[model samples]
Target: MLSGGSTGVGLTARDELESTISLARTADKRGFHRFWMSEHHGMGAASVSSPPLMIARLIAETTRVRLGAGGMMLPNHSPLLIAEQFGMLEALAPGRIDLGLGRAPGTDGATAAALRRGADANDGFPQQVLELLGFLDDDFPSGHPYRQVHAVPGPWQAAENRVSTPTGTPQTWMLGSSPYSAQLAGQLGRPYAFALQFGDADVDTAMRLYRENFQPSDALAKPHTLVSVSVAISEDPAEARRQAGTSAMAMLRMFKREGYLLLPPDEVQAYQPTMQERHILDAYTDRSFHGTPETVADRLEDLHARTGADEVMLVVGGHCASLDREGISLIADHYAMPRSEIPLPVAAQ
Candidate 1:
């Protein structure tokens, strides 16, 4: 099934945030299975600093698309608090909520330090995942320090002990671009999402490790996996590449520690790249899928065949809101995704 991933990139935070809502609505109408927003702090290129808040907003705007964080960086906050926030979200949307957890800081060192306040929480990601799961399930072992703690509005609060319809916990997913997270997700039997959009080179190895270590758990019966890929699709291949170049430029800036900014396509086309910068951009472009809908769809199909991923999450790329939405629509059309008959709800005045 097709899904979407957004980082809310635009010229301004307000515009980017609003664009995300619009994109989510479009994704829902186009029959995309899920729509996930990413969390990034102190990045000018990305407006979403809190995926939970964005997810909640998207939930209000869309009718049936699964809403979630592409992920919430676990080390940046307390497990109990996350459990509580997501629990409330699950209560609000029932089976439509997803909580994809990740181990990275989701920002630069300085910003990460500010967020963590000198805590070395990244090293304890596995423990935190367990703690968060415990809170969500309200099933911590006896004598555990947090045994008495409960995430209110959690799965334990389902009416009549029901696990369907109006009562259910958020579907939990493990998001990562590395082997550590892959193995952990497998060991815990959670659905794993590999962030291939970021140009991670170890996708094959990571996927292998995850399946090898997978263990059945209450949350999952088999090794479920999704690979998030960067995509730029258009009727014209050249136009698609032009749009994708902007993202490559942003990646180059980020690698240089110059901060991330998605320059407009015209500006990106005019800029000159040094040999090293050119290498970075070329590598990113090579790994990303950008072309006409036919080409991108074929690449995605090949990816699934190679990795055996259960789903392919597209991180549609472009320098503007319209192009991003267009890319999503084009892919859906190419795949013959069923269109939703439900119209988007009108916003309040």
Candidate 2:
């Protein structure tokens, strides 16, 4: 089932992060399998500056759900560090962690440069990926005998509180909005997560390409596709529309803004949108699985069955604050649980 954490915008970034963790923990208690967060940089709209770090924190906070970076931009940092950080998290959280890597810098050129630690413009991504894989495998031959080198905090030990790391590396995934990413994920035998929040310009094509190019690895013997969508679910469609409206307007505003806009839920209804807002909202609206739990569940099931996707992730409450405990209750009861048999804990105050 779909699950998400906070994107952390404005003054609420930290608090939102906590709330997201709380929410994900609650969802985990309710049986959602995975919980993820997106990565972003330097736009006042959302504070997803360090998704890996945030994911590590989330791993610490939740129990059963797999914690993942909806994506960490690959080009922005050293792959070794990414491997190390995720390796530690994998060790800490074991089977319940996912590493979703992306190729984009997640920011514009200058900001990308600032994040890159002075690396030249053409740093090798394919090579970096290979190196990362090497590190994940202890048999990579980088070192041996006298001084063996393996990923620190590798999945060898089973801590009392942490789950065992499934006798292999963390489940690796690739996130992209393009066919190229689909091809790459397929070729690498990793799961593919499409950023439907951006736009599904070629979603079907991407999925087809992924399945066509797929090569089986130890982690995935076949192709598994996941699509991420922005959704605002509430009993009141109009209220949901109004609440997610600011985010819709913010998205419209981004055509001229320096960075992408991911408007928060609280700001949706109160903000005045521009003339182009209707068009922007409509475009994403086609993809959003909103409405009541039954309606949303029907839409979600249709999307999954149509795509044959193994899973879906929704960014709920992005544009509306009206969704609360009861809304989540509805989702947990009907949409998230396998048989609607699992009882969710009382909502956290």
Candidate 3:
């Protein structure tokens, strides 16, 4: 499951870290496949600006769960720097680090421009990804200009390439909400992950295009596809709708150009949307699953059947940490995830 490091009412930065750590521990104990953190800048809803920084902390705290960036925006930073950072992570964690790359800015235009230092935003997403992989693999072609440059502490060890190190390489993933990224990932033979959580995407169509166009590269032997979704499960129908309301309000505000600020549940309960908003919320409800464990699980099953997803990454949320944790716990239980050694008590209690 992917944790966006959600920040809710009265949640402090310290609390955000603690909650994420707690969630990671629980996921690790439950044997969840991975625990990825999102990267966002200048956003109130999410607190983590540097996923790699948090991942470094998480690696020391959790023993089993694969920790990674839900994505690091490729347009916002240098590919060589990312290779060094993730390479370091692989060195520390061995087989447990994943580097999910995205083309979006992950922030407001102003902030994105600031992060990129006025560089061209749409210039070269696919090229940057290839550069990053080349750095990670230390395999630049002979004619490439930057071929001599190497990411230190990288996959390659020794001065003259005569020796090797046991430091594992991070698995590279391409994450997107659009067909462009899907097609690129397939053509490059990288694992493709689609963000269905807050995307206006045709997940099945995207996946099909990816699989049909896939070409094996050094990173992958065949097409690998994963879907990310947000789930909200509640036994009480009212509560489930309430949870969906928060997300709706956030989207409503965004649609109106107000921004992605999340309103409190009480405020959302009192909100009345326009005809346009009503349509948007209905579409959102159909895209995501919100109900009891059984109901949500069935929806996820159908989603998988439709998308032919090799894996589904749950990007969950709720009004608060407790509720969010409980929602994730419910889904985990339905999937028969073993109880964490350090059970999720804040939610359970």
Error of 1 at 298 (Å): 1.1
For each candidate, what TM-score against the reference?
0.94, 0.83, 0.92
| Tens digits of lDDT, candidate 1, 90-132 | 8778789888999888899999999998757688889999999
Best by TM-score: 1
Stretches > 4 Å off in candidate 3: 158-165, 340-349
Give lDDT tens digits, candidate 3, residues 196-308.
88757788778878988899998799898888887667777668767776776676666676766656788877777788888886776556678888888888899889888
Q: What's the TM for model 1?
A: 0.94
- RMSD in Å for all candidates: 2.3, 4.6, 3.3
**What digit string (tens of lDDT, one per residue) describes model 2 on residues 217-289?**
8778989999877766677876556545645555666666635555665554455656676667666665566
When 2 and 3 are scored with TM-score, the better candidate is 3
Candidate lDDT values, in order: 0.84, 0.67, 0.80
On the 0 to 100 scale, the lDDT of residue 62 in model 1 is 83
**Top lDDT model:** 1
Tally clashes: model 1.
Answer: 0
**Sorted on TM-score, highest at the top, how do the candidates line up?**
1, 3, 2
- Where is model 2 more than 4 Å wrong at Cα? 1-11, 117-123, 141-149, 155-168, 258-277, 317-326, 336-349
